[model samples]
Target: MKQDEMIKLGISIGDLNGIGSEIVLKTFDDSRMLDFCTPIIFANTKILNFLKKQYKLSLHFQGIDHPSNAIDGKVNVVNVWKENVNINFGEEDTKIGEYAFRSLEAATAALKKDEIDVLVTAPINKATIQSDKFKFPGHTDYLARELGGESLMFMITDNLKVGLLTDHVALKDIASVITPDLIEKKIRTIQETLKKDFRIRKPKIAVLGINPHSGDNGLIGKEDEEVLKPTIKKLRDKGDLVFGPYAADSFFGTKNYKNFDAVIASYHDQGLVPFKTLSFGRGVNFTAGLSKVRTSPDHGTAFEIAGKNEANLNSFKEAVFKGIEIYKAREEYKELTENPLKKQGKKI
Candidate 1:
């Protein structure tokens, strides 16, 4: 893929009632977005028109019947739904959930067919989307099943990059899944993803301990000492720059996360709480180990402030930009890997 051949990006419009539509509209309004890649929004034209009227945002939607008909330097939207369904901003509705899932399915199909270079998804309501027709925990699990890869969720920001070992699982169940093999698998996934996707050479990973002070010599918990420590040692021996079973509480505050390329969190909130607190609106959620590139905003569907025109579009914009960055980086890394001697003569 040459730089002149514009990368085709597919945007899955998440829950219509949520901030997904708003952010998508806002992101396209910026002309600079076209400079990097051509965007195709998989959404209903009626819903987008409604948002335009409600928010009074400056955006023009060019609906295309086919992907080949998509125009450059314009917001090309593939209208999935024709009817203008009732949308209650901030209210949870099964209809919106269905629409969101449909959009995702369409985007996923396009990615698999190589119609799109990258996929940027907006926020979706997990609870409402779990009905009879559409049943999945969230995008991570759904995407994993669709793409056929070991999926790992990683939060990326300017300061911290953290991956979850067990995501969207209960706190009690986390320990049961925290085995040496699972930990090692997640670490290796992160390592390979950083090198291949993000183009980080010799990535250093920090694994977080499940217990406080890493079990304090087994006084607090045995899993940290028994399971996590051994996993870290095994990875180190395998020539991976992996360290710790580190204390989760003190690690974030001491700026230790900056020292590593990525951190592996034991569970959800153990890493997300700190990550969101620090990089909430600016953070980008990237799904690693997938066959295709998928990135989304860190925040969820903010139902309370949905249609009030008060939702922030910064995170979605970052998600789109980060997707482009990673895609370009992956291409560059592939070039270097294919011809290492070519890189030898290049400037350092």
Candidate 2:
């Protein structure tokens, strides 16, 4: 990938019954999208048409047989399904789920074959997609499995960025899985991604503790003192700017999150509660440590306002923009790595 070359993006249409089609249609309406990268959406044309008619959008979608038939200034949609089916918005159907899964699988296959530069997925319903054929947790797990299952969930906002040590797990089971090795692995993965994908030369990561008041020095729980502290010390001794065992509650309250480049939460809610509060409809979910770039909007399917056309495309728009940014950044990093003198004494 060259800096001057155009990046091609393979987009997977999320749940068709949800607001996925709406956001995809709305996002392509913006003319500025053409300036960033060439987008190829893997979805049913019938569903896209339904949303366009429902929303009364003026944008036109050009259905193509393959990625090579795509044209500029027009939304290129590849029909992954052979048959055109009726889509009922705000209602869940197994056929729609299967179609969504197929679209994602097609996009993933294209991505694996180097046909596209990055993948920007729309949201999908987890339960609906967990049938006999597609038995994965969500996009993160599904993509991880497809891409050799080596990845971590990295959620981002302009103000705060949090990476989970354990995601998509039950609350009670989280404590048992919060081992020192797992914490170290997640931290290292995030650190590497910050450098490679984000173009941060030296990323400073802040690790959140597992207990209240950071275990109050073993008063509340020993996990903080016994597990988290040693891991942070180890990472620091390795010349990594990793600190904490910081109490999760006060860490975000005192605006302490602003000090570091990224935050590592011990469990799911410990990080997402504050993260969602600050960036519910504005954040971008990035899967770090994949061979190829992958990103999605932070928000999920807004079933309540599904057909009302009140869904906000801001997060989806940001996800696309961030995907482009990461792809470009990764290209630059690769270039810099190839030619170290190009970045010498240059302000990063």
Candidate 3:
């Protein structure tokens, strides 16, 4: 794909009652965004119209039956459902969960069929989205299973990239699930993603410690000393530029994260707190290490502010751009790898 080529962006309309439709409507409000990529929103046309009318917005999009009919210079919506579903703002129910999953399933089907080039998922209720058909911790886990690869919850921006070994696990169980092997696997995925997806030839990664002060040299805990340090050493010995069981407290405070290309958090909060704090408004939650490109806004379904038309579209907009950027980068990366010896022109 060329730099200015139109990438098909598949968007699963998250919980309709939340800000998913709002942000989606707002993002495509400007037709200039259409120049960059054609957005195929997997959502109910009627639901989107309701939001548009409620806000008195002019974000008109064409409703189509399939992504095959997506048109450039227009916002396209593929209907996943037809019935007029009532939206009770600031509410959670099983019906809402089912509705959200319908969009996600349709979008992923398109992704698998290559109908869409990249995906920008809207926020869904984690608790609600857990049905028999969709049984996983979150998007990363669900996509990992569906796509047949390990997924890393990578927070990405121009300055910092953070990947999580243990995603959506309770804090208490994070230690049990995040072993050295798990760390190495996820880190390896991040390394490869940085190289291929982001075009970082040699990426430096930082691993934050689970314990305080990396277990204070085993004073506070031993997991850092016993598990994390040894893991870093073995990975480094294998020629990966990975560093540290750095203490979570000072890792971002001292601007240490600036020294690396990416950081791996032991658990969700240890990484997300600093990440959201720094990149919340414009950051992207990129599901790295997958065969496909998937990015979402850093925040969740803002039920409180859903219908108020007050949602910030920066993060969601960034998610859309990030998806396109990664797609282009991966394509270019594949070209380079496919013709590796071409770099030297068969030099003697």
Candidate 4:
């Protein structure tokens, strides 16, 4: 296959002290994955080679100076940095954290320039990744700034899809942040993501309440009645298929989420807790509403089992597949919109 014909998958090696490298190697160890996309890992080949020996894997990486030099059907590595970085698995070293940021920075620059097609990022240690150059809570915030979009943390699996209204925010600040404007923006972002990225023509979305029992008619709190209820009602009045402010306590316990295309949660824990519970090993965290497609494993850097050769590669592999799918879906959506007459003829 030609390089242009293959989807160029740019990967950022997350915290080296974590399971990022392990999962990346295990996923691509299958030669069949090369048939789908040409992966360019943004890290030094020497370091990866060291890990290759430690894990005793049989994958070979072709080193390249730039992503454009990537060869199809080959695992490629961009030398984002030179020299050796000591790798002590299960330990958080600030030096390793800097190298993690370096890998991500290079890959994101390639994404912005269209040097690569889609990006599947490995998990990063949120606390360790904090520095003067990288001050965001996580990848989503940094990507939002660099890629230019109102991003939504959309956690997805085959059977369930959840979007967070407020992600990476403190528990106490969630209520104040759940304003009418914030709720509306997030819901619209989810709707656009469903339509363009997921190919849902008319998506039905459900919103979980802020307070228990949707504020118990203003007894528990007035945010649900004053903020959520009005905002969701406004969106519905405009012919959007959005429902809820459903009582959070029973929304998922009753399987009410099955009725909608996606569920929008009021806060991080409210959405992710149920999401991770239902689909721990299978979920993909997709950053929706961005110009470029990006995804990551829903789970984090499991320091406990970093180099034990016991990390499950399912979520990381799923993330790679999901990124490619969304990239193709977006391209198809763009093509159909460019020729409205062709799109109209298909319906007839």
Candidate 5:
């Protein structure tokens, strides 16, 4: 947040066989953006250069040995691998998966060492990124273990912000994980993120029900009527503007989500299905409750569009800007929290 030093942005190139490199390159093509922050990409220069050629891009990247040695105005690349990896677009192979993990691992190290201010990751093939070393489902699980925080997946955009109770889990596994405790923890994390990261002083959060008709008065399911309603009551008593056990089907369709600052969905699909439907090309997945700042584009690898010069860079660009905004917001929030003010009563 110090204005003296440029915010060093660390990026992990996702599955090389996908549209990660294409979107990343397009996001940094505008040299004027360098005036704001510096980017340090963790990937092989050869791989990115291949993407560049395929896309017919004129942009040049500076190969740096270290993140700290990155130039101010140029797109900086720290080669994580030395080999010239082949570009096999639209394939979920072991080689690209290993490469993606290598880049993410190295970038995460730089983040922990305070070499970068924020991390904006490219999309990785979650199924393929599995290996002996990295066995997590996706970025949230891996980053949660690496950073040691109760990471919650939040989808952010200018229009709406939604966080999930269970992220990157199988549908069968979600039912077991949907305990009252998990719901409460995820909402708490979302509340804190809205306050600290997004700078919402009194965040009004809306929680969605797990069932289609919110259990239809317990005829379909009891979790919504029994678990969610009571949890909202408890969380609200603790001084949070929490509301809802509304059915997910009608919440967004009726334009009700606009009334709250943030929404907590019962699971990943319940939240993301609506979020991506509205803000598909512009949404950013923010990992809230982590000590370090991390975000990624809302969309996935888009294997069909890889190397076709059809990938949209809007989401990736917004991810970088969102990272910078959250970092600044956190700094300001810390300053405000440190200097306490005298208590005052509320006026109706």
Candidate 6:
């Protein structure tokens, strides 16, 4: 595909001290990826080149000043910085975090300006990346602020998808946050995303309970009975195929998750633990309910294996592929929704 014809993939190079750069280089090293989308990596070309040499990668990339200068058939790097910073592998330096933020900031700008069709972010050290400018916990919060949409952290693979109701919140605060309004909104977001992004026409969603065995029907706790049960009933009455507040303990073990289109967990670990276990290297962390498409690898910054060339690039590659797929799906959905006659004709 030519430049205008192909999707422009905006890539943010995450913490230089981590495996972000390694996976990014390795993923684009495959020549076949270029045929799918034009990758515009947001980071210093000099830094990338240094890492490229360090890893002994044969990937050739051209330096560009902006995303518009990206060419279709080759990897393009936007020089977000020009300074030469020392790269110490496996080190958690604040300076390294600044570079990661710079790349993400620039890539997000391009995305907002329509310079890029989709964004695939590499892993970042959440701790080191914090600054006065970045008060949010992670990418989803920041992207939601910038992109102007309700965002859901949707971890996905081909078969399974998990959405979080309360991500990055403390264990004590999980229940206080799970109100009826919050549950409804999140479920709505998941439902819309499944229909528009994944093309699931009638999505059957399952919700995991906040307490063990769903509070053992109030014997273990009343939050499941008082909060989740009623809220779920309201949604079901509204004709949504939403079920559960199922016991988190046996939900996955019983293979009940396979019966639904997606599972909504109350907190971070409740959903991600089982998800990462099942789809570790193959899953993509997709930020759903945004007007723009954004995805990342399922894993985080592996500081232990930063520059060792021991990083697995499958998740990163899947993130790239998933970003492209969602973008296309959204575009098709827009066309069909904007002109319902065309959709009806297709049905006929």
Clashing pairs in 5: none
TM-score-better candidate, 1 vs 5: 1
Q: Quote each prediction's TM-score.
A: 0.96, 0.95, 0.96, 0.98, 0.96, 0.98
Collision count of model 2: 1
How do the residues 264-333 of candidate 5 rate in per-residue lDDT, one tens digit apiece?
8888899999999988998999999999999999989999988899999999999999999999899877
Q: Model 3, poorest ten-residue lDDT window? A: 339-348
**C-alpha RMSD of candidate 5:** 3.3
Candidate 3 segments whose C-alpha is farther than 4 A from its true place: 1-5, 341-348
Runs with alpha carbons beyond 4 Å of true place in candidate 6: 1-4, 346-348
The CA lDDT at 334 in model 4 is: 84
List runs of model 5 lying over 4 Å from the truth.
340-348
Clash-forming residue pairs, model 6: none
**Candidate 4 residues 42-73, lDDT tens each?**
99999999999989999999999999999999
In order of listing, the candidates' clash counts read: 0, 1, 0, 0, 0, 0
As a TM-score, model 5 comes out at 0.96
Clashing pairs in 2: 144-149
**Candidate 6 per-residue lDDT over residues 1-348, each given as its tens digit:** 233699999999999999999999999988999999999999987888889898898889889998999998999999999999888999999999999999999999999999999999999999899999888889999999999888999999999999999899999999898999999999999999999999999999999999988998799879999999999999999999999889888999999999999999999999999999999999999999998999999998998988899999999999999999999888888888988989878652
Q: For candidate 1, lDDT tens digit of each residue in 30-109? A: 88889888999998777788788898877888898766677899889998778778888899998888888889988898
What TM-score does structure 4 among the candidates reach?
0.98
